[model samples]
Target: MISKWNYLPLSPEQDAIKKKLVRELSLSPVLCELLVQRGVTSITEAKKFFHPQLSDLHDPFIMNDMDKAVERLDRAMGGKEKILIYGDYDVDGTTAVALVYKFLRNFYSNIDYYIPDRYDEGYGISKKSIDFASENDFKLIIALDCGIKAIEKVAYAKSKGIDFIICDHHMPDEDLPDAVAVLDPKRTDSAYPYSHLSGCGVGFKFMQGFAINNDIEIKKYLYPLLDLMAVSIASDIVPITGENRILAYHGLKQLNTCPSLGLQSIIHLCGLKNRELTISDIVFKIGPRINASGRMQSGKEAVDLLISKDMEGAKAKSENINQYNEDRKKLDSQITNQANEIILKNCKDLDKRKSIVIYNADWHKGIIGIVASRLTELYYKPAVVLTYSNGLVTGSARSVQGFDIYKAIEYCRDLLENFGGHTYAAGLSLKEENIPHFINRFESYVSENILPTQMSPQLDIDINIEFNEITPSFFRTLKMFNPFGPGNTNPIFCTKNVYDYGTSRLVGRELEHLKLEMVDSRSENIMNGIAFGMHEYNDHIKSHKPFDICYTLEENTHNGASNMQLMIKEIRPSE
Candidate 1:
């Protein structure tokens, strides 16, 4: 993909963070500057980031419908009612199902899990699920990572005497679902301070409230559930700030040592044990396999594996998920290549439009969002990639940092049949014929609202530290900002004129990474480095000279050895 090279600098705002850090933390200029650059100007903020805990979490009832949801959950556990945990088919939904199924199963054996099929039932709560629950005498249904827009399904469940509770984070419409308790932070009436909880986070919170109310030792129950929340948080691309930071923070901590059966199967397959896993691991490695089970086959498979009890069962489930991921990878690559070709041939008039919307009768709906991501990478604009068959159109939209895709789609209300997503990601459906008008209208809407400055990718560097100032001790203090993601990101700094000592070929399929050695700019000490997706730039980078680049400090481990290394983000070849 041809990504946009435009970037937002980190100098001006960073200077202010430094000043604030000096006054607030009462520290030396260098340390204070680092804190400020990381959006931690106050001493309190720094303390919290370093030591995130359960106390930093928001009150679960603050989310709209928490009380009602809790009431229904209490009733289910109280009466030993047969409960079905319903969820979507992706990583977020699968993790949610696992989190709820395991938590609830501890108190009630009548608990079972269900994930709707992507092709069969589409997204969210379904009539088929309600019918299944009814047939099995399941009285309580808790919908996770989905059900925010399931008004008809919720009503149908209620009529059948099946009380419903929703633990979701998707944006909701004007009319809320009539479920007995609808827990969603994105609801307009929601007073939850942070609205970016992933589906599992809401599910976790619902369980958290129940655990606290019952005096079940929230940490004992909740801590074990962090790995699930971490997977969802990373997979869904939510901001890792406030409550989310704490969730990802502790989730990652336990993720290293205490993966659940399903997660352990997946982690063992990835050869990760007693290792510090980052958000990128789940994003690129683990999340894909879990999501693949839903996209390529049945979402329920991933859920089954997640809630699997024994190693044998978990391994069997993981093999299925692995197979699906392998199939998905082939399909995704083929479609992405074709979509890129489609854009190159047909999107000549793209620069004039504010958005990119493409539809191919043959495009696979399973990977349209991946295509949308590819389109955004190539075009630097909000994009919607769709597949049309018969009269129905389903598509995925990926937005730039400045564009709120769901809100932008709201402007084209007349053309869409159904639409829902977060600020930067969304999914929608409409008739094939209405697409052109929706495309044209959505373009106009974006052009009117988005600013030129907002089009550039913002790189928020936490601090500017020379290579000499970096020491082994700083890594420990830096990890105080543990569990980095959207809000609490691993620090990136600018280093100028680092010495280059060539590189060794990092052998991997498709040349996924590169390894090199360089001399520290300030100390004249040698340092090891690795850069991802940099093989194509190898010639430009290693063209017989030293280079200045932007990178981040990272810990690299291999063969029972640990060492700090620099992960280069970008490089400028000498002119």
Candidate 2:
């Protein structure tokens, strides 16, 4: 899986701006270049980027129909109407449901929550769940993370005398659902400044709006909910640029200092307690466990773990959820291996194919999405993992950096019974017979539209710098750019004319990692670097010749001492 390295070029004007920022902030030129590349040219922008504040969050009322949504909720609370917090079965949905349910419970007690079973009800506002709400005498249903596309289901609930207030962030269809209020910033008419909020972030905004309308301090209700928002933002893979950044910034603070009992139990269970957890910690460690509940079993258990107030109850639920996560890992690994084998054996000319579409009727639907993502990492192309269930071919799709997978799937809509997703990921179902045609059409669509560059992975190098710049002060300033994600990513710096000082070794249980004592050719500055899964480069580095490397700086603590280490991204022989 070789990738093209794209060394970003800086214009003279941009260089001049970086120089000015360097002079104004009294920072290193390399740090200034990194900031300039991220669109932080001015000191004001740098201040906001480096020091994100909760006060910087936008007003929740800026979202369209926020007032209506809040008013409907207030009415429901005043009338003691049975309000149900409805959400999807994933982490974003479960966390959103938990956040809203717990917050509303603080003020009103006539509230319960519902998470549709992934295997039974599928995704989003289902007809069966609506019928349950109708039969249970529930009058108000606040759908979180979903319902933006549930026009028919919302209408059905409406006919049953149930009103809906939807809080979703997905791209909505033109014909909006006839709910009492739609609280999606992605709504074409929405005025909210930040539109890339996670589902839980949108739900938190509703709570913010409710607090404002009630003349109560918003922080009293909002601060406690930041942990949930952080988990959703990280897990949902939303852009962490605007409000999402603020929420994640503060939410991580809450998670480290005083997490909820459920979160605390999960942290303890994962052995991540007494440490500052990062977005990656939540995304890889915490988020997966939370999502595993929904994927392997009932998502209600996840919501239960999230909203539980007692330590004992949360611990009990955490143990169960942890086991589910363990089970999910086993299945995920087994399915990924099976999918890889299928691709290797079936696809003769893997390079000629623009997309990957593999189907196994016996494949578990719960792990298809994970397997699709895994396949993309190895194949470096759009992948669709399908399984036959209930006489239909159902599956998940994952795309590369610049590809629009949902649009590609939409091109084959005639063959697909239903499909929905954004640019990089989607889900679809079709008849068994249409599987071959859908695969051909989808492959043809991708081959015709996708660019040559889009077919292969590309690493975007932020800047080229010398090892002299890797100082304690420089690393400290870089640490200000915390909570990195899709929109704002960690800076990848390329250092030219670098070589291992006769101390490079392959380290790791499988001897698959390259540990190097890298030295700068110009400054003779030394830095320890580790390239995980790059043992193939051991001979290249041990040659003692100058080479170029791209990497990110990370603080590695060992034996009670902390020092900066380069986490190598790519290595190349110097030209």
Candidate 3:
């Protein structure tokens, strides 16, 4: 599919800032302009952006109910009452549970953790889990990644003499839960500086508040769990800026050097041992394996693997999780194909539709979210993929770049049994009979709100440069923009009027990829690049014609030699 290239040149004000930054930082003008685009105007902000410190993290107690959360947890631990750490069944939730459970288990006994069964119990603060907690004589339930909107479930737990302290980051409703403390940065009344923390991040802040309240040393107990924090932030697709950046930066350092036994085992399984890990590594390789456990089996298995102390046990569990990931991939591919066939055959007016709402009663409930995301990417529309489960139709929603899928889901709340999520993604359940009404309402909401340009893919090019501008030193300086994600993305550079260097060829299986060696008029450098699924352009690329290409620089190693390669995004033949 072709994509529009959207390049926004620096404004005059930004040009002045870029010039100043280039002079002060002694960096290239293009690099300075990129920093200016990221709102780094001065030396101090640039320093902080490049070198994040743990001390730069916000005060945990600044959150509204953080004091109550810490005090309640302290009282629970002080009295030796049974404490249950409960969380949702995803990467963010499981990591939050593992981080909290691992931290508290060091000083407190009579503590346990619970993960809601994705099939049997469904998502978030299930009464079944509450009953399990009560049956085991638990007194306090610290809910992570969920329970901010569990008004009735918290009331039910309260009736069972179980107090709840919710640590969540999803957007909240007008009425808060009756829990002892609600720690969510998205809360309207929240004063916390950063609102984009992952669910595990909120749990980390709760632990931070607890440590500060009790005067426990942070270096030994708290900082060690940053590996889990990094996983959650990267996997959950949270904005990697401010406090999240600081945590992800250090968390990646920990992962590369001395990760937990569980992560280390999985890293070995991924064949990534002895290599530096980045946010992309977590998103593409590590996070999926962790999520596969929750998607295929119980999420408690993921937490077990994450907090495992024994290397052998963790290695075995990592193998199990890897199998689950393999199974998940098969299911995801099959279901996505089926969904595509359904849309093509049934929905004849596809172009007129602004959103996608597809249902397959036989679809696996755990794999629908991935399918929804795939549908959004394939059709460039907000999508909802639903499957039959426990006599109800449960579904996952994924949105386009600028659309808010959760609000669209909430607009159909009266028809839904339950729904909660963030701007770009969400989940919901409804009676099977209400499926038609829900689809119509959801489509109507999306059609009314989605912008015209949002329905198409656009590649935001950071700057246009010549091949001569890409030096070894320049690439080394670019490496400092580590741990890239939603807010701070890897820069995409475009170069025009470039022709293949006569060594380009098709390489991948079935010859569906382009392995290119190219040069431009400005330089004799024959840069190497690989463009996947662009075999259609192979002849044109070799026709001695120039084309404009936008790509991100990546380090490729072969036979112990490392050099820069362009991970090409889009190619436009010169007109």
List TM-score per model, in order.
Answer: 0.90, 0.97, 0.98
Candidate 2, poorest ten consecutive residues by summed lDDT: 1-10
Candidate 1 regions with alpha-carbon error over 4 angstroms: 1-31, 389-391, 453-460, 501-516, 519-523, 531-546, 573-575
Say which candidate scores most in TM-score: 3
Better of 2 and 3 by lDDT: 3
Which lDDT tens digits does candidate 3 get at residues 457-500? 98899999999989998899899988788888999999999999
Say which prediction, candidate 1 or candidate 2, comes out ahead on lDDT: 2
lDDT of 1 by residue, 109-160 (tens): 8888888877677777878889999999999988998888888888898899
lDDT of 2 by residue, 1-575 (tens): 55688986779999999999989999998888888877898999899989898888898888999989999998998998999999988999999999998888878899899999887888788899989998999999999999888898999999999999999998887889999999998899888998899889899999989998998677787688889988999999988887888898999888998899999999999889766799989989999999999999999999999988899999999999999989999999999988889888989998799999999999878889999999888777999999976567889999988889988998998998767777888888899989889989999999998888876779998888888878888899898988888888888888998988877899999999999898878887878999999898788788787888989888887766888999999887888
Local distance difference test values of all predictions, in order: 0.80, 0.89, 0.93
Which should have the higher TM-score, number 2 or number 3? 3
Pairs in steric clash, model 3:
none
Ranked by TM-score from best down, the candidates are: 3, 2, 1
Q: Which model scores highest in lDDT?
A: 3
